[model samples]
Target: MRYLSLDNQRDGFILAARVLMMVLFVLFGWQKLAGFAGTVGYMASVGAPLPTLSAIIAVVVELGFGFLIAIGFFTRPVAIIFAVYTVATALIGHRYWALTGMDQYMAMINFYKNVSIAGGLLLLAVTGPGRYSVDGK
Candidate 1:
């Protein structure tokens, strides 16, 4: 019988989740920066009051939080920030129930998925980054 210590398991979880978050953040953030016009247009389509400003903010938040998560520096704060940001995205961008005159059902499902992921991120924030993190040192 072999057993992984509590600390080891927690660190493994943190590492996996952190890497996933890093990839997600970097990709989305880079999209916003690389395709500024497209991002602005998408924001406008989604009824963003200030599409340009929203794009900028999204880029910064995703990139900044992504870096923070990757390094495990202030992991809790970064995770919380990401959780809140994802929630807002789910609400505003994928307000599925609010969609009308088309296939609205699918939108709601996606929104819920985003919400679930946000919940996971919130959990990570509450749990901290465990023994493998910079804060654990």
Candidate 2:
């Protein structure tokens, strides 16, 4: 019974993580495609040199990696990519907001949040999707 409970817990965790990944990625991917102009503008605002390239990357990463995450296919690779992307975005975009001083405290908080998320992604990459995943089969 104890083993069964442990299995159940791990399965629950994987499912929750997968679902969260799916929802966030799908929404982000849709937004990138549907609001290309908005995405381009956001990229420009963040000082991204190639807004078009940024948009393509966002869409591909969100949709492609997101699907792999949801289905538990190539989970580690996808998670690694997401982890790197999160860290890079935080450093490139949010770091500037923090440099602007105390008025942009929210930027610092968000930067930390992104780092935390990257940590979680790294953990998932290492631990995998548990027994609930298709790959686990």
Candidate 3:
């Protein structure tokens, strides 16, 4: 078996990573928008200050920034912002330690998942979007 050269694989690898990273944001953002009132209610239940405003911000950051990152436009700053947002959301929304039983287990899983995603975004910030991206051009 032969491995592709790093130079040859870099752009494709970056594109794949970017796509994967953006999918969750895009889908969830769309869901939030599609069920705007429900999302606002959910945010309020989670103790988010100004639930409507929080919902809007979540939509913008998730959908807007997610799209920008997917296209590789302003990749570094976007990824960094997203990384911060991911950590914040995980802490605020996934308070696993405060929960019990299955809820605790689920929240813990989500918290760790968010952390992992944030790690990926940080990597993208450092490595950039590569040659296939708008930022690259």
Candidate 4:
């Protein structure tokens, strides 16, 4: 069977995918900043060291780097960093093994979601942002 090709719209496809992938980070990061105290409290509850600092870093990575990814600036490096960050967050925040019942199920779902997002980021890193990006590659 023949498969449809997106070669003609590759750049547009990349831009759309990048924007979609980063939108969650941008929104969540903004939320974290808007509710700084609440975010810090949650981080502390999760046993994160220097919760305030962690929150700040998370905001930067999510908002700043996420924007960069969306705009296709430094696409490869940003994708790689975001991929690692996604996995790290999943492992740190979604410890399904440490929970039970519904909480465990929820955490497991989120963990896998994060992992899947990371996989997409990794693919973006390899393929790049395409010709319409700042990298123009």
lDDT of each: 0.81, 0.81, 0.95, 0.92
lDDT of 1 by residue, 9-114 (tens): 7788788888786787788898888999999999999887699998888898788777777778898888888888888887878877777755577778768877
Task: Please give the range of 10 consecutive residues that has the lowest summed lDDT in model 1.
Answer: 1-10
Tens digits of per-residue lDDT for model 3, 1-137: 55756777989999999998899999999999999999999999988889999999999999999999999999999999999999999998899999999999999999999999999999999999999999999
Query: Tens-digit lDDT track for model 4 on 1-137?
Result: 54998889988999899999999999999999999999999989888779999899899999999999988999999899889989989988999999999999999999999999999999999999988788885
lDDT of 3: 0.95
- For model 2 the local lDDT of residue 115 reads 89
Model 2 lDDT per residue over 1-137, tens place:
25456554877788788868577767878888899999989999888769889878888887877777887888888899989988987887687454766746878887898888889889889989777677888
Q: lDDT for model 2, please.
A: 0.81
Cα RMSD for candidates in order = 2.9, 3.1, 2.2, 1.4
Could you give the candidate ranking by TM-score, starting with the highest?
3, 4, 1, 2
Of candidate 4, the 10-residue stretch with the lowest lDDT total is 128-137
Sort by lDDT, best first: 3, 4, 1, 2
Candidate 1's error at 83, in angstroms? 1.3
lDDT of model number 4: 0.92
In model 3, where do residues sit more than 4 Å from their true spots?
1-5
